[model samples]
Target: MAYPWKSWDRALFSQVAGRHWPGAEPVLPRLSRAADHGRLWGAVAAGMAVVGGPEARRAALRGAGSLALASLTVNTVGKGAFRRARPLLEAVPVIRRLRRQPVTSSFPSGHSASAAAFATGAALESAGWGALLAPVAASVAFSRVYTGVHYPSDVLVGCALGVGAAFAVRAVLPPAPGVPRPGPAVPVPELPGGRGLHVVVNAASGPPPLLSPPAARIAAALPLAEVSECTEDDDLAEQLEKAASLAAGQRGALGVCGGDGTVRLAAAVALRHGLPLAVFPGGTRNHFAADLGLRGVEDTAAAVLERRGARVDVAGTTALDGGARGAAEPFLNTFSIGSYPDLVRVRERWSRRVGAWPASVLAAVHVLRTCRPVDIEINGRPRSVWLLFAGNCRYSSVGLAPVRRRDLADGRLDVRIVDGGPYARTRLLGAALTGVLTRSPVYEAAEVRRLRVRVPGEGVHLACDGEVAPAPRELLLDKVPDGLVVYRGRR
Candidate 1:
C-alpha cells in the first residue's frame, strides 16, 4: 500500500536542509557526535549526581531511565517497522555529513528519541531541571538533521516517540507529592499529676522495659490517670480506640507506652479527637521517641505535666490492594519496602539469642545475602529496588547509629531508594559494613509530600514504624502536615 505521508515527509526534509545556515554547520555536527551511543546522556546523569541537589539527582536518574526506554523502542520497533532509507549524500554538504553514519533505518532518529525522552522525563520530575535540559535536547534533535544523517520528518517522529515514551514510563512510577501547607500549631495542655491523662500499654511490643508492668509504673507516676493494658489476645487497634474514647470523655491527653507502631496508633487517635499524645521510649529502637529526644517514660511524663511539646507532621499510607481495609494508617518514623522487612524479620527471630545490636548486624548480612530487588512501579515507572524508605522528615546521618530526623514539622517525606544493580548483595554488605550505605552510589534520596508504590504481584511486605504489614498491590504515601500534637521536654 502506498502511504501518502511519505511524499510530504521527504518534501519537508528537503526544505529544512535547503534553509540550513552556515554558522550552525560548524556546531551541529559536534553535538550530534557527542550524543553517539547515548554517551552524552550518561554524562548528563553523572553530572547531575555530582553537582545537583536531591531533586536534580532524582530527575537525572528518571531522565536516564526514560532515555533508555526511548532508544530501545525507536531502534527495535519504530525503525524496523518503517525501514526508511537515510537521506541522499548528494543532498547534503560534504562538511556537514557524519564521518560514520548510523547503519539503521532512518524513519525515526534515535538521537532525537533519546534527547526528547531525557528532557521530557526530567521535566516531569522537576520543571527547573527540565527547563535547563529542554534547549539541549532540542539542539541535539536538530543536530541529527543538520549533520545530514536523519531527515526532518525522521527527527520529528523520533522526538514525538521519545516524549510519549517518557510519559509512558512516568505513568508507572509513583506520582509526585503536592505542595505542603503549614499546619496550625496546637498548644499543649498541662497535666497536673496526670489528672486528665489516659495511657495504653501494649505488652507484646519491644523489650521487657516497655512490657515491664507499665500500668503499675504509670499509675505510680500519675495516680489520677486511666491506664489500659493490651493482652496477647487483645486487638491493639481496639485497645487504642478505647483509650482514645476514655481520653475524649475525660477531657484528657492520650499516651502510648510501647514501640513505633503503638506511637503511630496514639498519633492517629490524638489527631482524630484533637488531643495531645505522649510518646514513651519503650520500644527497642524507639525511633519516634528518639526523634523527639525523649529518653524514657519518665521524661515523656514530665513533658506532659509541664505542657511542653510541638506539633509535628505525620506520614500516612493508603493501601491500594484492598489490604488496608479502606483506612489510611499513620506512621511516626519511617516506612519501608523491599529488604527492610526481611531485615526486621531476621532481627526479631534472632534478637533473643544474640541481643538487639548484634542481631541487627547479623540480620543486615543475612538479608543482604539473600535479598533480591522488588519489582515496583513508582508513580507510573517500573523500577527494581533493593530498598525504598520514606522517613517522616529529613534524616541526617549521626555517626554509626541509625538516621535521625532533624525536623518533625517540615511537612515532607524523606524518600531514599537503593537501586538493585548487579552484585547488589556484595555492594550492600560492603556499604553496610563501612557505614556508608546512605552515601553509596546506588542510593538516591528526595523530599516529597506524596508518593505511590505499586507492585505487579500481590502481598508486598511493608515495614511501617517497626511493624510489618502486607500491603496491597498499590500504596499511596503522603505527609499530613502538623497531623499530631505531641509532648516533648524543652531542649
Candidate 2:
C-alpha cells in the first residue's frame, strides 16, 4: 500500500543522513578552532564579562568541560533521536571534504555546532582562541552550504544550539581560569624560564657571499654553529635547509650567519622542523635583521653566542624569481612586478664585477627612459598602475644599506604601488640608489595577508628581495608570525 507520508518521510530522512565518526580521532578542525582561536578569544571574553555577574563568573569556570560534554550529548543523544539525511545526499564538492557520512539529521551542522559551542565556551574561560571561533565556525558552515552538503538553515540552527549550550553551562558552572587574580598583571614571558638557542646562515642563497673573507666576520661570533660553504652553488636556501634539518632533527637550538633572504629560508626550514632560526644578515639590505634589532653581522653574532636574543615574528613572500613577477614557488622579501624586478636583475647580474652602484646607475637610466604603466587591483578593487612592491618588512635605503625601525613586530606585509610615469619613474630609479619607497595617494599603500596581482598579458618579471621570477600577474606574499628568530643584543 502506497503511504501518503512516504515522500515526506524520505525528505526528512535525507536531511539527517550520515554525519558521525567513530573510534579514535586525531583532532577535528572544529575542536582545534575552539581551542586555538588565540587573540579572537580576547574580545569574546570582554563581551562575556558584562552580563554574567559575580555569581555568573564563578559559574563559568567549567567552560571547556561543558563545551565537550554538550558536544557529546548533541551528537550522541540528540542526533539519534532525530536522524535526517544530509544535503550532500544530492552530491556536491564541498561535502566531499567532510571526515565521514553524517548519520543524524543534517538540520544542524555538527562541525558548525561543535565549533561554535567550543569557541564561546573557551572564550568564557581562557583569554586566547575564543575571539576567532565564530568566524571559523561560520566558514565551516559556509563550506557546508557552498558544497551543497547542508542547508543554510541547518547551519543556523547548529550555531544557536552551540550558543545555548555555552550559556547554559556558564549559568551553572564556576569560573575556570584567567580571572586575573587581584594585583599587577604578571608577564608570562618575563617569568623565569629557559630559552632555546638558534643560529642561521644560508651558504648558498645568492647575492649574500657565504664563502668570502667577510663570511669569517659572521662565523667568528657563532663559532659553535654548524657551518657550510656554497661550494657547488646549491644556493643559500639548500645550505640552511640542511643546517636547520640537522638542528631540528637533533632537538637542539640553532645559530646562523647569512643575509635576510638566507635568514628567511633557514627560518622556514626550522619552523617546518619545529626548530628556531637565527640570523646574521649575510646579505645586503639585511632588512629583517635590522627590524629584529640585530644591528649588524658582528654584533648579531656576539648576541647569539652571548645569549641575549629573543624570538621575533617573521614576514615572507613565496615566489619571487631572479627574474620579475610570480611563478610556481614563493619568495622572501619585497616583490617587484613591473620594471623594478628587471632593474634588480640587471643590477645583480652586473654587480658580479662593478659593484652595486654601477648596476644601480645603469638600471635607473633604463627604467627612467622606458617602462610603461601596468594595471592593478588593491583589496579586490580594480585600479591601473605600473610599478608595484610588496614588502614583508619596512626598509629604507641608507647609503650602501637599508635601515628598519626596532620593536615593530606587527605581522603584516607592507605594500607600495607606483604608477608608470616619467616623474614616478625618476623616483623609482632614485629608490634603487636609496631603498626607501613611501606610499600615498600618488603612491598606493596596502597591508594584507593575501593578495593577487593580475597582469593583462603573460610573463611579467617578479623581483623578490633581490631575486627575480617570471609569471606576470600571479604573486602571493605571506606573513609568517615568529617566522624567524634573529639574534638580538644590548645595542
- TM-score of each model, paired residue for residue: 0.59, 0.49
Expressed as tens digits, the lDDT of each residue in 1-491 for candidate 2 is 23354465456434433334332122333333333322223334455556654333432334444556556766776666665566544534332334454455765566556656766776666544455455665655555554344566666766777777776675444233221111111111110111333344455444644355445665455554455555445565666666666666656555555565455456566666665445666665565555555556676556555555454444544433334644233344566677677677777778778776687888767765776766655445665566677665443321112223323345656666666555665665466434354432346665676666555565667665566666534445566654444345454
Candidate 1: lDDT of 422? 89
Local distance difference test scores for all models: 0.80, 0.53
Tens digits of per-residue lDDT, candidate 1, 312-431, equal 888999877755535788998888999898898899899999888899989988985787888899899998888888888876642212356557788888888887888766775577
Model 1 lDDT at residue 490: 52
List, in order, the clash count of every candidate structure: 11, 70
State candidate 1's TM-score.
Answer: 0.59
- The true-versus-predicted C-alpha distance at residue 114 of model 1, in Å, is 56
For residue 330, give model 2's deviation from the true position in Å. Answer: 6.6
